[model samples]
Every structure is written in C-alpha cells, then in structure tokens.
Target: MEHRIATFLSRLSRTWLAAAVLAAVAIASATPAPAQDFITVASTTSTEQSGLFKHLLPEFKKATGIEARVVAVGTGQALDMGRKGDADVVFVHDKVAEEKFLAEGFGVKRLEVMYNDFIIVGPKNDPAGAKGKDVVEALKKIAGTSTPFTSRADKSGTHAAELRYWKLAGFDPPKGAWYRETGSGMGPTLNTASGMNAYALTDRGTWLSFKNRGELVILVEGDTKLFNQYGVMLVNPAKHPHVKKDSGQKFVDWVVSPAGQAAIAAYKIDGEQLFFPNAKP
Candidate 1:
C-alpha cells in the first residue's frame, strides 16, 4: 500500500511538471520580439551601383547592431529627401548642393568623406577627335563635332558637373541632336551611352563597377577639374524632430572615422581602388 501511494505521488508530480512546461512555452510564444534598430540614408546612386553600401553596411551592422537602409537616387533627390525629413542621413557626392541643403536648415553639418575623379567615356574609335583632351576640352570638342553624347539630366551631381563643364566650354546646357539627356542615373546613362556609342561623363567609381560597356572607353580623365568629392550629413533634427539624430550622427562619425575610411579604401575591382578617402582630420 505504501509503495502504491509513492508511485501515485510521483506520477502526479510528473504531470504537474509537464503542465508547467507547456504553460511556459505558450507564454513565450505570445511575447513580442525585440524591435531592431535601423536608420535610413539618402545617398547617390553611384554608391549603390558601385556596391559600396553592400560591402560596408554589413560591417556596420555587425559593429553597431544598427541597420542602415539606403535610398539611392540622384544627389538632388537625396537632398530633397533630407529636406522632407524622409531620411536620417544624406551621403552624396555634391558639395555645393549639400552646402545649399545645410544653408536651408535641412542638414545640420557636412563633412567631406571621399573622392574619385570623373571621366568622359566614348567609343574607342574616337569619332569625335575627343580622345586625350582635358575633360573640359573634351566636352568642347564633343559639342563642336556634334558627336552623340549621353547626359544624366536628372539634376544629379554628375549632371551638375557636366553642366559646369559645358558652361566652361562655352555651351550652357549644350542642346543639340547629338546631346541626349536620359534624365536617369549614372549607370543607366552609361548604358545609354554604351548603346548609342556615345560619350558620357561619369564618376570613376561607377565606371569601374559598370560592366555594360559595348564600345565605350575612357577618353578623358586625369583632369583636376574632374575631381568628384563625396560628403555625408545628418538631417537637421531641429527641422525634422523625428529625425534619428543619434543614429544618423553615429553613421556620419563612423564614415569619417579611420575604420570607415579603411572600409571605403578597401573596396576594389580588378585591382583598381574605386574611391580614395580624404576625410578631414
């Protein structure tokens, strides 16, 4: 009789233990998961097409547990997004536009991050006699010869720079049957250039990563005026109270930091470094 009672108590205890385990699991299943930390960055298409963010964001996430969501567009659009408080950070290659954004109180601060030169790519056959000319001089020749040239007329930094060169070349917004404005990003404009065997101005980073070259080759480069400078800024929290100030500043700081500069410098294609880090001390 005592042994029977002992077995019944043991079974009862086992049943209660099983019931407790089931209750714990049900409670755990109903609990919500912790929200992930993330920030949105408005940046230029060159960084996205060049695969720079793909190479850098993973490292950033691993280091800070903050996911960076990038909206890659032309510099004009990127700055517009910042002005509208759609992004926490803006990373773009247009210093003048960025300064204007800051002056308008859309961005709090601007820091020069990295640089790469722009190059004018055209047919290797050199139909326009523009080969080996200085970048501005090349534009002059293309305008003079009326050679087919593609332009990203989306008000991007590239487009703005192309306009500057045209202005210097005595052609303000060169318009002709030969000048084609695609109103697209760098990569797509390059694709247009490649398709029509036309000349197009492009940042070196995009040109290095671009693989759709049909007859296009670098016809003009190495001009100091071709320098392409990139900058990063935090959206003004004063204007956009919802802006992720801390997180955005963190990204801006890290990008100019030695570690972030190293990551940018390390990105290469076919043994050619795409961007050179020159963040001010």
Candidate 2:
C-alpha cells in the first residue's frame, strides 16, 4: 500500500512539474521583444507627396533593418526642425538655404542626393497669359496681373526659390490682394491652387502625385532658375549629443552609397523619375 501511495505521489509531482514548465513557456512566448531603434527624418513635403517615401522606404527598411520615421514638412520647417535637434537627419532641396544651414553649423556635411526641376502649373486657359516664356518673365506677367496665384509661403524651399525668382524678375509681390500666401504644405497648396483656379509653382514629383483636381497644366518649365537640387544632412551631433550618431551616419552612408543612389534612380511614378541621383560631392 505504501508503494502504491508513493507511486501516486510521484505521478502527481510529475504532472505539477509539467504544468509549471508549460506555464513558464507560455509566459516566455507571450513576452514581446524590444522594438528596434528608429531614425527620425525630416524632409520636404514634395518628396513625401510624390509618393517616393512610400515606394522607397520599404526597401531601405528591408536592407538595413532600421525603421525610419519621416516627418514631411516644407523645406524651411524641416530645416527648423533640424536646427532644434528635433530630427536626426534632413532631406531638403533648397541650395541657398542648405548652404546657410551648413555654414551656421546646424548640420554636418551636406550630400547632394538628387535633382529635379520645378514647374509652373496653372490653368489650361493660362489666364495670366504666361506660357512657354522664361520663368522670370512668366512671374513678372503673373505678378503684374491680378489673376489669382497661390504661394506656399510656408518658407519652404520652393517658397525660397520662388522669392528668388521674383526678386530676379524685379517685382515685389504684395502680401495681400492678388498674391495668396497659403501657409500650408505642398499638397494642400496645390489643391488650393486648383480649387481657386490659380497658378502655383510645384516640384515635378508633387505635381505628378497630385490628382482629383482641375486641369492645371504645367505652364512653364525648362527654366535654368527652376532647377532644384536636393541635399541630405546629418544633424550636428555636437549640438545635440544625444542624437543617435550611428543611425544617422548609416542613413547618410546609405543615401550616398551606390546602392542607395540606384534605389533613388529606380523609383518611378507614372513612368517619371521623380529624383535623379546626384550623390557625387
């Protein structure tokens, strides 16, 4: 009888041990793994609106196993974010502003990542009667007339370029009246221009993604002043030492590397290359 009791006790102990082991296994399996570090990127709305990020970031993530959190704003705002150490990196297309940022030590070496020209989009009617003319002359015509025109005025790289073009054209557009300052991003500004049947300057990429709007044709292009170049810069780690240096460097390296350049070149929308890789220098 004692032997029988001993056997039963041993069996119960085994069952309890098995149950404990299974519970521990279940608890271990239920625990989630730590998330990978993310690189915060502040970039121009044009790049985001053009669907380039949507098409390109997945490949980057797959290649590097690092997640990218992108914040798309106007060039000016993006720069501001970088200056505040709010972003690990920035991708913007304004040459003058980019130079200023580098000189100010807000960011480190700027890498020329891509190039795309801006286009003056307006109604097919061409109400301002400016088409097929030099960009400066076209702006003069647009400003001279009271015809509705939209300006992103968000201090975007596009805005900076537009202001430079206007200054070159020798016309100072008034704040109110015919000139409308839409303190918005590229996509919204484009939609506003379409809704108001006004003229707007837009990057080729954003123009390509913009749809569900009136027929706003590319009225003026092929202007030398309209040429746009994009640059990627790492936020100066000295200013914000907490900034992830390794991840930031990796992003910069990937952007300028041959493989990354090829990826940029391969990205397309509606059979149009939104950005041409210009990583040299």
Candidate 3:
C-alpha cells in the first residue's frame, strides 16, 4: 500500500510539471507583439542638405526602434505636406508660417529646435558690390545695380525672407535682366545662380553643402534680419486622424532634447557648424 501511494504521488508530480511547461508555452505565445516601426517626416532642404538627418537619425532609430523616413523639401512644401496629411510632422524654418499653421490647427505643440543666419551668396567678384554691407543695404545694391540675381520663388521660407528683404530695401524686385525667379528649390536655385554667375539669398546650411559651386561666396551676413530659426511640430492628429501622434511626439521631443541638440551642434561641413541648436521653448 505504501509503495503504491508513493508511486501515485511521483506520477502526479511529473504530470503537474508537464502541465506547467505547457502553460508557460501558452503564456509566451499570448504575449503582446512588439510595436510597429515607421514614421514619416517632412523637412527643409537646409536640414537635408547639411546631412544632419544622416548623422543623427540612426541614433534615434537605435534608441527607439522607430525608423524615420524623411521627405526633404522646401519649408513651403513641407508645411503643405503636413497640411495634406502626407507627412506625420514638419521641421521647417518659417516662423510666420508655422505660427499660422498652429493658429489654423494644422499642427500642434510647435517647438523651437535650432537657428542659423541667411546670407547673400554671389560670385567672388561681387558684381552688385554687396560685400560687407548689411542685408537690407545689400538688397538695395542688388536692386540698384540690376546685377543678375536668381530667386528661389518657390514660396519657401528663404523665398519669403527674400521678399521681406526686398520690401525692407524699399524696392520691389523688378522683373527683368536683374531678377530671375526659378520656381524650384534652394539647391536648384543655387545651381542656376552659379550657372549664371548671379547672386542668391540662401540659408547658411545649404551654402555649406553646395560644394560644386565654386563662384558663390558669402557676401552679406551677420545681420539680425538674416536670423533664421527652425522649428519642429507634430501635425495635429485631430486634423489628420491617421497621423501617428505618438511617433510624431517622439520625434519632436528627440529633436529638442539634449542629445538631439548635441547631434546638430556636432554636424558640420569643412569644420563649420551649419545650424545653431535653439532647444529652448
């Protein structure tokens, strides 16, 4: 009788152990899946041209396991992409347009990320004689001399700023030999200007990235009007219900975070810092 009881207890213990192993397998199979990994961002040519994303986004992906696919365009197109729900977020340099976007509820939680000054770039000969003058004065010369100048004219942030400079200079840029509008992006405008040996108003970052253009030189710089600030914002999920708010917020937060600022500060061309990180507010 004692032997039979002992045998029965041993069998029961083995049976329970097998049941526990099966239960563990079931629990493992029932565990929640890992989140999906993809996000879309619309940003400016300067950021793309400066190679900041290539330098920084891998770090973001490694940390968060979220892949960022960037669509690089002018600030106007980037904002428009966000408005049209083609992009999950926007990182751009036009403060006025960004404010308008927020006011219109197209985007939310707009945050300042970085800043850099715009400069007038032209042939080293300085045909307009714009060198060393202030931005407004330079524009006046560019207009007064009727020196060949190329304008982006793509409604980009840089284009908008150029128009502002023209206004400040007390002259509407005339349509003629002196003024040429290319309905293209910064890179293309730079190429066109270089081809024509014409002056162009451009952000510092794009100018730094423009290597093949040898004639272009920074003519007008260091003015307060040339101050260009870039901001990042998550598209309002309420407006575009498909926009991944979680991923967008993560991107915005990463860009403004200390790590992201450090990455921006570290990015350079020919040892020159392109963008100044303005992570505050």
lDDT of each: 0.93, 0.88, 0.89
Instruction: Summarize candidate 1's per-residue lDDT along 229-250 as a digit string, tens digits.
Output: 9999999999999998998888
CA displacement after TM-score superposition, residue 147 of candidate 3 (Å): 0.6
Which stretches of model 1 miss by more than 4 angstroms? 1-32
Q: Arrange candidates by TM-score, descending.
A: 1, 2, 3
Superior candidate under TM-score, 2 versus 3: 2
Q: List the residue pairs that clash in candidate 2.
A: none
Candidate 3 C-alpha error for residue 139, in Å? 1.0
Runs of candidate 3 with Cα error greater than 4 angstroms are 1-36
lDDT tens digits, residues 13-107, model 2?
A: 99999999999999999999887878999999999989888877887788788778899999989999999999999999888888999999989
TM-score of every candidate:
0.89, 0.88, 0.85
TM-score of 1: 0.89
- Sliding window of 10 residues with minimal summed lDDT for model 2: 169-178
After superposition, which runs of candidate 2 have C-alpha atoms over 4 Å from their true positions?
A: 1-32
